[model samples]
Target: MFTRIASALLVAGLLATTAPAAHAQTTAAKKAAAAKKATAAKKAAAARTAATKAAAAKAVAARAVTPKAPVAAPAPLTEAQASAGVKEALNKGIIKAVQFASEPDGFNLNDDIHIPTPPDLEIVKSTVGRLPGMGLVFTQLETQLNRAAEAAAPKAKDIFLNALANISITDALTLVTSGSTDAATQFLRRSTQSQLISAFHPDIEAAIDQVGAGRAYATVTDKYNKIPLMTPVNLSLADYTTQKAVDGLFILLANEEAKIRKNPAARTSDILKTVFGR
Candidate 1:
C-alpha cells in the first residue's frame, strides 16, 4: 500500500509540470498571431494611402494638360490712318526738298534738268538772223515758251503734294531703301498721273492762252509738219506742260533724296525715326 502511494504522488507531480509547459506554448502562439494581424493592418493602410496620392496626382496632371483658348488678331490700318502716315513723312523736310528742287528754277538753274532746244532748232535760230525780221519773231517766240514754263513751276508743288499724300508706307519704305532719288518721282507718275493730268490740264490750257504760247507752238509745229515726208508733228503747249510736270517731279525727288542722306530734318517724322534712326 505505501509503494502504491509513492508512485501515485510521482505521477501527480509529472502531470503538474507538463500542464505548465503546454500552457506556455499556447500563450506564445496566440501572441504571434496577434502580431501578424497588426502588421497586415499597417501594410494595408500604407497601400491605401499610396493609391490615394497617385489618384490625386493623376487628377492634377489632367487639369494641367487642358488647353487654353487662342488670342484674337489686331485690326488693319484705315485709309485715313495710312494717309496720315504718308503725310507725316512728307511734312518733315524729307520730301519737301524734292518739291523745292523740282520747280522751274530747280531744273533751269541746275544744268541737269534743262530740256535742250532740239538740235534742229539751232539751224532755225541761225537762219532767222539771216532773214532780217524773222530773227525777232523767233527770239520772241522762244522767250515766250520759256516764260510759260517758268509760269507753270508753281503748279508742280501742288501736284507733288497730292502725289505724296497717296504714297503708301510700303511704297515709301521701298523708295527709301532700294529706290533712286527718282523712285518717289516714278511712284508719283505711276500713282498720280491720271489725277495730275486732270488737275493740270485746265490750268495748263489757261496758262498757255495767257502766255500766248499757243500761237508760237502752233506756228513751230505747223512749220515742222509742212516738211514733206517728215512725221507730221503737232506739238501742244498742254502736252509740253504735262511732260515738264513729270520731269520736274523726278528732279525734285532726287534733291529730296540728297537732303535725306545729309540732313537730319528729313528724318524728323516718327516713321522716319523708325526707318532711319540707328
Candidate 2:
C-alpha cells in the first residue's frame, strides 16, 4: 500500500508541470497568428494607396498631351466698309444732336450747353446784376438766348449732313482708324465751323428777334448804360448767339461720336459695329 501511494503523488507532480507547458505553447501559437494577420493587412493598404496615386498621375499626363481647339481671327475691314461706317456713324450722331438741341428748353436746361451772360456783359452782371429788378433782365436775356439757339438747332442738321456727304473716302478711312474718340467730330468742326457760322448767323438773328432775346439784351444793356460812370456795353447778339449755338452743336456731336467709338451698345447699325468694333 505504501509503494502505491508514492507512485500516485509522483504522477500528480508530473501532470502539474506538463499542464503549464501546454498552456504556454497554445498562447505563443495565437500570438504568431495575430502578427501574421496584421502584416497582411498593412501590405493590402499600401497596394491600394499606390493604385490611387497611379490613377491621378495618368489623368494629368492625358491632359498634358491633349491639344486644344484654336480660335478664329476677325475678318479684315474693307475701305468701302470703313467709309460707309464713318458716314453712318456721323449721320446718326448729327441727327441725335440736332434733335436734342432743337427740343424746348434743350439749350436752356442743359448745363453743358447752357448759354450764360456774354463775356462782354460781365461788368454789367457784376454791377447792375446786384440791383433789384436789373438782375432778372440778365436772366431773361440768357434764357431767351438759349431759346433762340434751340429754335435754330434744327437748321444745322441739313448743313451738317451736306458737309458729311462731301467727306472723301481717304478722309473717312482716316477718321475710322484714327484711334481718337472725337476725331470725326473734330474733323467736322474744323471743316464746317466757318460755313456753319456764315449760314447760321441770319437764322440765329431771326430766332433771337423772334424769341425776344434781342429786346432782353437791349433792355439789360440800356439799364447798365443808365448807371452812373458805367461804360456802354455793346455786343452783337446775333453774332454771339450764332457762335455759341454752333459751339453747343459741336459739343453734342463730339459726345455722340465718343459714345460710338468707345461703347459697343452705341454701335446701333451694322456699319457702326463693323467699323468701330475693330
Alpha carbon lDDT at 81, candidate 1 = 46
- Per-residue lDDT of 158-227 in model 2, one digit per residue for the tens? 8899999989998988899897899999999998999889988888899889988888888778888998
Residue pairs whose backbone atoms clash in candidate 2: none
| Residue 78, model 2, lDDT | 81
Off by over 4 Å in 1: 1-110, 115-130, 133-136, 156-159, 218-233, 262-274
lDDT of 1 at 126: 51
TM-score of each: 0.51, 0.78
Give the per-residue Cα lDDT of candidate 1 at 64: 95
lDDT (10s digit) by residue, model 1, range 1-278: 99999999999999999999999999999999999999999999999999999999999998999886776653454444445543554444334644454445554455555444444555544543455455565655555544445555556566667667667767665655543544554666677667656766677677667877677656555565566776655456576665665565556555665565456676666655444332
Q: What is the lDDT of residue 258 in candidate 2?
A: 94
